[model samples]
Target: MPEYNAPLRDLRFVLHEVFDAPGLWARLPALAETVDAATADAILEEAAKVTGGLIAPLNRSGDEEGAQWANGAVSTPRGFRQAYATYIEGGWVGLSGNPQYGGMGMPKMLAVQFEEMLYAAGSSFALYSALSSGACLAIDAHASETLKRTYLPPMYEGRWAGSMCLTEAHAGTDLGIIRTRAEPRADGSYAISGSKIFITGGEQDLTENIIHLVLAKLPDAPAGPKGISLFLVPKIKVGADGSLGERNAVSCGSIEHKMGIKASATCVMNFDGAEGYLIGEENKGLAAMFTMMNYERLSIGIQGIGCAEASYQNAVAYARERIQSRAPGGPQARDKAADPIIVHPDVRRMLLTMKAMTEGGRAFASYVGQQLDLSKFSEDPAEKQAAENLVALLTPIAKAFFTDTGLESTVHGQQVFGGHGYIREWGQEQLVRDVRIAQIYEGTNGIQALDLLGRKVVANGGAALRQFTGEIRAFAAADVPHREALLDAVQRLESTTDWLLQRASENPNEVGAASVEFLHLFGYVAYAWLWSRMARVAASKRAEDEAFYDAKQATADFYFRRLLPRILGLEASIRAGSDPLFGLAAEQF
Candidate 1:
């Protein structure tokens, strides 16, 4: 297996060159003192060592000896417990947590790079810690001060882990129909009675306790989604003195036999009147849950990029080593049977495509991470609001497009390996299976498109769309040599937005019908902006590192000349809206 190295150079380029994250960090009062260029670079270097040297080695073994369920207890694969111990001991679980609560309080922009490395190293192992961090963030933000004090520190230290229980067998996307219930008791706490399926990190031996943020409905609460409430139900309840009490009512019924991420335990949890405390106000669970959901949605997208990076590294290594037919014009390696597979044009195309998409996705994630920071820390209220709106508008696109492209890139990487790719030993097949869940979970890509079209775009009368497009236009107008490609991308986005708005005005079903294509079109345009910015930065830094910089420029050129043209096909499909999608009769089949 090839060793995984964090792309620190690319990360720095995206932060300092593409987004100027240092300037943004300096402007934010909360981050100004803690996160400078030196600090960020040092963090990246350490994260690279931990991920590449320690975590990557366990990936293949983890897959082979996946989490095992004996009786009701879950046991993680070999080396995972030790790796997780190192991860927590290094304070990685709290990289972006509150400083007051024992967290490192790192900015999301910097933490995102660490996240990318974790995913690249071993996504299955990373999932457990990521969920813990995300759940802790939500609790710290919305839960009572008492709850935060009780839970936040331990979770940050990784003495305890966390899980989010939202999905049920019948109520995956439609939470309005969920059957979970929470009954109030004499004390402030409630007894949660429900069964949650597909709960990641729900039950495991890696931690002393598992804190679950579950959604259940109150008996007297209105009805549907409006009646739902969020609860903090721990596996083992903590007494008022901060010591462990009796085990809570929650139990792991069974572990899921998933297609990928086998090392991460996904369980069907049966909460039989589990002792639970409300996180926020009643009937507002969805609103509070969005705090965690939004974070996870973007994190899942990074998971895609991370897996794609891993796949690309392995594929590139394989292509350079595997010998095949000689070059068309001349012999590059006459000592071998023919020449290395890297000399082939078609293999080069596949590798380049993966490179372009993976790098583009990294730049895009960094850009979104910057927006998230600005939204929380900007001094001006208007700037904050604009940042928030941008985050909302682009989040679904980030989640859907990055993961979609990730799966495609991983498949292409697998193709580069030919028959060896299909076998488990090469680890190519695992990357494909693991990346696929990123699209399906955290609200499916189809649901993400619906959210973008119905709630964010059409319902808001294109306010968010206009805000995003304005920035893209301004970037294109700036001094970038790839101005033509940038301008073309901007115009294409404007055209697609106008068509969707006009068609959806008269046709109610048009938005849903065109949602997926619209999202892809938006993603292509967004990636074009990132590619252009990266190309300019790479060109300016050519003297420092010619190979890396040249690679960036080549990929950008490929994205513009080859990949951006796909928007035409999507636009055509969107313009032919609703009719084909909803026109088919019910009994036609």
Candidate 2:
């Protein structure tokens, strides 16, 4: 198995050097006194230590043992409980929760770094808390103050955990057809009766109670999605006095056996007259549920990035140590029978591609985190609205593009290992299987692409897209190394957007057909912009640190020269429109 090390220096580089996150925190009144550069650095260091020393060593072993399901109860792999105990004792679960409820009250920017490290170390262990954080956010944003006081503290203290229960056997992306029912009680709580599938961390021994944010329909409400409502359903119902009461009517029927992240339990939950409390106004559930979904979407996207980082580290280490055929130019290592594989051109191409895309993704994730911070903490109304717009526009792309490229990067890493990658001993195969789910869950990549183009772009008359690309052009105005290349790439995206918008009016299918390609085009351009900004920063600071900055600039150069041109093919595909797609008759197959 491969050893996992936290990318501490690069994480700090993305936070402090590339984005000036500390300066943003200082400017926001809400975060000014909450965190600073020194405090943030200390937090990052400690996060690295916990994840690397404790959690990472369990990745392979946990997969081997997997989560166990017996009768109505589920148990996690060995060491998960102890590791989770140490993890929440550090106040890690509530890192970005509301300060009024015993959370650390840190900005989302810092939480992003910690979450990335957690996923890289052990995805199965990381998911238990990931769902809790998202569920906590939903309850904080919509639940009443009384409910918040009763639920948030114990959850933050790690005595309880949370889950999101939205999917049923019949529904995945479309929620309008769900059959879960919620009946109001005289005590103001509701009785939820239904079953949810694919529930992550639905039942686990790591925490005492599992708080579920469930979606169901009211008996006296209208039909379809408008009638749906959100509820806070707990495994063990909590009394208003802040004490654990009898177990609710919910039970885990079974747990899934899967390809990767086997240590994380995917459950089938049966809620027979389960006690649940209303979250927001009745019949407005979908809107409230999206608040949690958006947060989970970004977190799940980071799962892809974390796996990619682990794969890169493993592949790079092996490339340097694994001996193979001699170099094409000459025998680089005369002392050894065969030269190191790193000396070959094809191997270098694969390694460099992984390096460039993974680092580029790190920068973009931090940038999204910065926007989230601005939208939440900044007092300026215009700045807050701008940040909100960018978040809405970019969140979908982050979920889809990062995972799309993430799968590609992981496959390349596995290919670098040759036949060894196919076996389980090297740990490369686990990463490939684990990262594949990111593209399928939390709204599939296809769903994200549709949301980006259909709702965010074409529906808004390209204003949201222009809002994003305009920022890129503004930054590209600087005299960076790839300034012209980035500007051209942004222009290409703008033109493609215009073409798709015009075609969508004439033929609605154009929107769906052009969506994935359009998103990939936007993703490539966004990375080009970030890579340019990184190259400028690395060049300016090269005098202080030679090797690190030199590597940064070289990777940026490679992204522009080698990877940036791939956007040309995407542009051509988008221009092809939806005619060819509809040519196939429904009965042809």
Candidate 3:
């Protein structure tokens, strides 16, 4: 198995050049004092060391060992406990937590890069961190002040971890179908009774206690998603004095044996009359859960980016070393039996495709990160509103597009490895398996597509799309050297959006059928804008290092010339409408 290394140069470029993250952070009073350029660089450097040195080594072994279950107890692979200890001891779990709760309170923009590195090193290991942060974000945003005071500090300090219990056997995406019930007790708490399947980090030995954010229904609550309520059910109960008390009623019935990310335990949790406290108002669980869902959706997209980077690194290494037939021009390695595979055009195509998508995805993630920061920190109400709207519109795109590209990029990486890619030892197969979940979890990619078209686009009469397109147009209007490519991308995006709006109005099924492709089209154009911005910044720094700038420019050119052209095909598919998808009868087979 190949060792993982963070793409430090690409990360630095995205943070400093593509988005001017430091300048944005400087304007936010909450983050201005702690997250300067030097500090950010230092943090990235340390994160790189931890991820590459500590976590990367465990990727193959964790997959091989997987998680074991015995009599309701789940054990992680060897060194996992120690790695998690290092993670908590280093305070990484709370990198972006509230300062009042013992968190470092770093800006999300800077934290996002760290997140990418973690995912790249080991997707399985990264899940633990993501769940912890997401659960904390939910609790902080909606939980009562007393609950925050009691739970947030310990979670941030990593003395405890968190999990989300949402999916039941019958309820996956459709929360309204859940049968879990929460009976209100006389003491202001509730007794939650139900089972949650596919619960990540539901049971683990890494932390002292696991806090579960569960969704259940009250006896008097309304039906469907609206009737759901959020609860804080800890594995071990805590007293009013903040001391660890008796164990709660929640227990892991068993851990799932998954295809990938075997090291991260997905549990079937049995909440048998678990003592739970409501986090938000009664019958408002789904809305509260969205607080975590929204964060997890973007984080899952980051997971895709992470796995793609891992696959790319390994594939590039293999392509450089594996010798095959002679090059088109001549034998590049005369002493060897044949030229290295890297000399071949097809291999180069695969490698370049992976590089273009991976780099472009990084840039896009940073762009979204900046939007999240602006939404949280900007003082100007209009700026904040715009940022919020863009975040809302782009969230689905970020989640669906990045993961979709991630799977494509990883498969391309595997193709570059030929037979060795299929074998488990090379680690390529693990990348494919681990990335597959990103599309399914945090709401399936199909659902994300529906959200983008139905709710986000047509529901608001294209308000969000128009706002996003306006920003892209502004970027296109800037007098940059890649002005033509930027303008063309903006035009492509506008045309696609207009087409979807018009077509979906005529056919409701069109939105459902065309949603996924439209998202891809949107992603490709957004990435083009990101790459163009990166190229412009790299150009200014060419005097310091010409090769780096040249590589950036080449990748940007590759993205626009080779990758962005796919949008045309997707546009054609969307224009075809729902005929192929919905026209078939259920009994046709």
TM-score on alpha carbons, each prediction: 0.98, 0.99, 0.98
Candidate 1, superposed: residue stretches over 4 Å from native:
none
Estimate, for each residue in 343-436, the C-alpha lDDT of model 2 and write its tens digit: 9999999999999998998888999999999999899999999999999999999899888988898898999999998889898999999889
lDDT of 1 at 212: 97
In TM-score terms, candidate 2 sits at: 0.99
As for TM-score, the candidate ahead, 1 or 2, is 2
Tens-digit lDDT track of model 1 for 1-589: 6579888888888888888888889988999998899999999999999999999999889988898887878999989888888888989999999998889988889888899999999989999999999899899889999999899999999999999999999999999888999999999899999899999999898999999999999999887889889999999999886688899999998998889999999999999999999999999998899899999999999999999999999999999999988987789998878899999999998998899999999988988888888887789899999989999998999899999999999999999999999988898999999899999999999999999988999888888998888887887777885788778878877777787888888988899999999999989988888888888888898999999889889899998888989988998888887888756688975
Candidate number of the best lDDT: 2
Please, what is the whole-model Cα lDDT of each candidate in the order they appear?
0.90, 0.92, 0.90
Question: How would you encode candidate 3's per-residue C-alpha lDDT over 59-163 as one tens digit per residue?
Answer: 899999998888887898999999988878889999989999889988888887898999999998999889999999999999999999999999999989999
Clashes of 1: 0
User: Clash pairs of candidate 1?
Assistant: none
